[model samples]
Target: MGDNVVVSNMELEKLLSMKGGKGEGSYANNSQAQAIHAKSMHHLLKEALDEVQLQDPNIPFVVVDLGCSCGSNTINVVDVIVNHIIKRYEASGLEPPEFSAFFSDLPGNDFNTLFQLLPPSANYGVSMEECLAASNHRAYFAAGVPGSFYRRLFPARFIDVFHSTFSLHWLSQVPECVMDMKSSAYNKGRVCIHGASEITANAYRKQFREDLAGFLRSRSVELKRGGSMFLVCLGRTSVDPTDQGGAGLLFGTHFQDAWDDLVQEGLITSEKRDSFNIPVYAPSLQDVKEVVESDGSFAINKLEVFKGGSPLVVNKPGDDKEVGKALANTCRSVSGVLVEAHIGVKLSEELFLRVERRAASHGKELLEKLQFFHIVASLSFAL
Candidate 1:
């Protein structure tokens, strides 16, 4: 097995380009289109920070956001935290503690995009400059740390609060048992006939366990003794080994189904299917508990499954008609990416139309099925 799966700069550019041009652009701009799960994550992080701050107000808080794509969400998270701190300071009649933030992600993630989003000069209120100057604070952002989360990337005892959202579920490689021994039959589009079942559902469970252990061990050495960690990840509710549907549903059922269709249509060769796996995994609630407990370094502070409500409905507030329109628009937007990836450019426009129509027909179903989990945990040991 490969020791690490690091996305190269070119690959990262390709992935981001699938969304359109430079730095989250339309996807990030559409407040209505942003994943509902992200907002819930923000809420959970705020609550965690409030709890941590109440326990010790004098300790300078250093917040690090992992897998912080393009740094837009990190900026949003920092904005919320700073605002909360100011409000609390006024309420308690105390000076605000120093604040610092670090944004970390895959080397391919657009740091330039994130930097462009930062204000040149902090504004009077809730501005980066004002917040830092007022609280004797500092902020820094960097990239180029790739591979599994188990590796050390920062100095010891440096981070006070670590936050990651909608990340960390990806496994480093496809299950080894899935590979065929004879002539790589599994890699030759014969997975269904041979090695597919060898790598049972429990394989993912095992991977999660190992990955989480590594993650916790690495974090334990990098976080301050009493610092807190907040992670919001996609998870499953069931643990039945026979439940392939459960595994497929959470990560990319649509993409998988689309891939199957493409194979039948000869757009993608069967050999490709046998050789590559999506590398996405959604651990069950039990799986999550088991992994966290195994680490024995972090304690669960808050954990809950959050459903992905219809983005259209969320954006429209109360208008059902507007909600429908917004949902359609979102489907259209996502289809653009799908067309580019699966269908060739020659058929991109036609495929997009087909996908949009399909989404219109099944949009509500997809919305109802989209759900994730928010896990807020705290670290209690010195690095």
Candidate 2:
């Protein structure tokens, strides 16, 4: 059980993708927190869209949702963009031009589910039914682009506006040094940098900077001269990577605890647990600003970090079990695939069940400590 297992790059790609489809454990059903976070930036998205000028009625105004997981949130975000742009054109006494909304994510993403979620109407469900009858302008077209956002996914200067939420924290992969047994940075007995050594944390930080810079570079080329981007990423209030208040560490610590349960039960070896590391890092506001400024591809229009209280929102206050389930499901929706890939389906199921139970046992305390950083930034291509 202690034997080392090497996972191929291809396997890592698939493993890192969010759980696909509309099943019980699917991301589509568990992305409420992300949706809430995105909605909190509705004004930012509107502001970004308002600055977008559709000069040609013939040319389609292109909008892209990078890291658009399979969920209503993606569609909802697109709907907001489309509606805002439509209204902006109308306010200017100009005819609204054609629109195109592209949803991009990794290859393993549930594109089938995303495409199916689209309404028959072309307006992205922004009251398209009424708009279709009221206006002669063409509705927006939808497409799925499957690939990593860390690389180019469109022609140079082709995209008009870009948006991403609950992403940007995911590195292209866990730092190689953390996975290399011979490396001093190897993260032993930890699934993330939450409690890892400074060397391992540094490795993760270096990888994050590289991935983010590459992402900005690719997006700069793909975006038009005046195009705008609104991004909302998981972030942290403290510079210290091990801060328990950091979103990544908060959720990750619980996950690591659940993984430890399996190890204690002898269901999996400690080495296996150590071998798996989540490729997520919550950057501080300064971390994001530095990367964007250094890249020099975009001008930072707005950048601020807000506290997003408990990812789980309980309608009936004091429902500890419900709160726990919500939090656990959100974690599983994102990390279930990785767990299942590492251990197996059965164990992964048991693992999350344990996650839920542990969370429920201390829901009140967990809820208080679950405050997450929501980094919202609005940017436009540099002159």
* Predicted model with the maximum TM-score: 2
279-332: candidate 2 lDDT, tens digit per residue: 888888888899999998788888998776667667754788986687678788
Off by over 4 Å in 1: 1-35, 41-43, 53-60, 86-94, 122-148, 179-198, 241-247, 250-253, 310-357, 371-383
Separate clash counts for every candidate: 0, 0
Deviation from native of the Cα of residue 96 in model 2, angstroms? 0.2
In the range 289-342, model 1's lDDT, one tens digit per residue, is 777777777777766665533344344334444433444344333333433443
Query: Could you tell me every candidate's TM-score relative to the true structure?
Result: 0.71, 0.92
- Model 2 misplaced stretches (Cα beyond 4 Å): 1-6, 123-131, 134-138, 244-246
